[model samples]
Target: MSTPVIFIHGLWLHASSWQPWADLFTEHGYQTLAPGWPGDAETVEESRANPDAIAGHGIDDVVEHFARIIKGLDTKPILVGHSFGGMIAQKLLGLDLGAAAVAIDAAQIKGVLPLPLSTLRSGFPVLSNPANSSKAVSLTPQQFRYAFGNAVSEEESQELFDKWSIPAPGKPLFEAAAANFNPHSPAKVDTANESRGPLLLIAGGKDHTVPEVVVRSTLKQYRHSHAVTDIIDFPDKAHSLTIDSGWREVAETSLTWLKEQNL
Candidate 1:
């Protein structure tokens, strides 16, 4: 049987954002599933209309939620995730949950150093307000432009913001930022686990949210692991690499890499 593929979305975007990716992967003969964070709405319009639905959820909540979904599947799936979801994919892989995994511009887990200024600025919306730690924060068009659409044109940035941006819980951002200081933080990952399935970390060279420096730091942490770990860099792309006009290129790259691993 063909290995199933599960797509995990990041903050501010719902599972619906992965529809095009799912369609493409399905055409390639992989059954795809994009499960949402707790309380995510079916549509971006609905999420915007009722932000409360996605509020108050934290990293642990989302990780457990996706874990349950993976556990119920007939076979371990090939996990693909973006941003925060990418970190989640790694966490799941540490638990020996997936057949293989791909993390696109993944958020940093504990032990990753070299936090860049651009990454801080990208997360300012949530970090600036302490109250936001327990609330959901929405991105302004300008913020989204800098963090998620820098590689796209102005018109395309606006369109992406309107269609995919929604409120995201602030707790996860705070937890990730403070992960190193907290011994019990959920942002911790077992990068050295030998049982972690083959993993790929995709980096966007121009991505402010997860620059190459940060991604390399993440890669460095996994260096001691016996599991297969690899990285590919798109030097001109930004955080929107997964959803921009050239998204198909990124998707194709991932598909090709997975095929090489015979997953």
Candidate 2:
């Protein structure tokens, strides 16, 4: 049987947004699944209509949710995740649950110390108000433009927002922001595990939400491990690299990397 590939989405985007990537991977002869967070609805409209269902879910909750899905698989699968999904992928891989993982513009994990101003600004909609920590927060088109589409045209940014944006739980952001200070943070990843499978981290230089520096910092966290860990930088792309018009480029790159790893 072909190896299974699980796609995990991050904040503000519905799980179905990965359909294009999933279709492409399927065409390449891999079985793929893109599951949402613990409380995500089946559709974008439904998720927006009932934000409370998605609110208050933290990092550990998301990791465990995906872990359960992995538990049902017949064989170890490759994990390809974006943003917070990227962080989740790493955590699972560290636990020796995946055959490989590709993290795109992954959210900052524990031990990454640089918190850029742009990162703060991008997360301000939820982090600005402590009350939002327990709520599901939606981003305005303008905010999405800054956080995820700054590298694309304004029109394209707005279009992307209308098509895929959804309310995101604020708890993950709160947990990540405080990850450095908390020893037992859910944002923590067992990067020191040398027995795990290979990991590829892709960064977007123009991404305001997760800048190149942050991705680099995340890479450093894996320095102690002997397992294969690599990073790629798309200097012209932003956080929306996974869902934008140029998404195929990123997807193709990931597929190529997976093939090279003989996965």
Candidate 3:
């Protein structure tokens, strides 16, 4: 049977943000799906005008959201997720639901070491507001460029902002730092063993929210994998590799990994 692939997005992005990647995976003979986080709005415009529509979305909500989709699938699926979505992907693997998993520029998980200055700065935008605890916040152009597309060009950045950008829930970011620290944190994932399948982590060197040190630290958590578990860092890429100047390269790499696992 052909292995399926599911794409999960991170903060400030709806699942439609992954259309190009999903379509790319489809061309490669893999069944692909990108499921939105609960309460995500229909479009960037709607998400901007009223982010409340997507507020209160947490990590557990997203993981369970995709889990439901997986339950209906004809086969077990490989998961590819970015940033916060990457964290959710790990949670799915912890649940032993994935056939294989690719976490690209994945967020920090408990027990993984190293916290970069950039990672702390990326959260600076919303760290202080109590409203942000349950609110969705939009990124300013400068903020987006700084946190996600620092290495991409202006026109390309503009295109990404116009097409895939939207307000994102702050709850996950708030939960990520606490998930492993706090007993009640919902951001906690249970990737205790590699029973879920093979695992790969793609790190963007210039990513502000998940730096190389952070990705390197993730290895220990995946030590339980019986399948191949490792990380590959793209030095010139930033957090937006999937949509930035070199998306096809990232996709090709991920495709190569998936093809090896199932073909």
lDDT, each prediction:
0.91, 0.96, 0.82
lDDT of 2 by residue, 183-206 (tens): 999999999998999999999989
> Which has the higher TM-score value, candidate number 1 or candidate number 3?
1
Estimate, for each residue in 37-91, the C-alpha lDDT of model 1 and write its tens digit.
9988888888888878788899999999999999899999999999999999999
Q: Candidate 2: minimum summed lDDT over ten consecutive residues — where?
A: 58-67
- Which runs of model 3 end up more than 4 angstroms from their true locations? none
Candidate order (lDDT): 2, 1, 3
- Candidate 2 wrongly placed segments (more than 4 Å): none
Error of 1 at 9 (Å): 0.5
What does candidate 1 score in Cα RMSD to the true structure? 0.8
Instruction: Work out the TM-score per prediction.
Output: 0.98, 0.99, 0.94
Q: Pairs clashing in candidate 3?
A: none
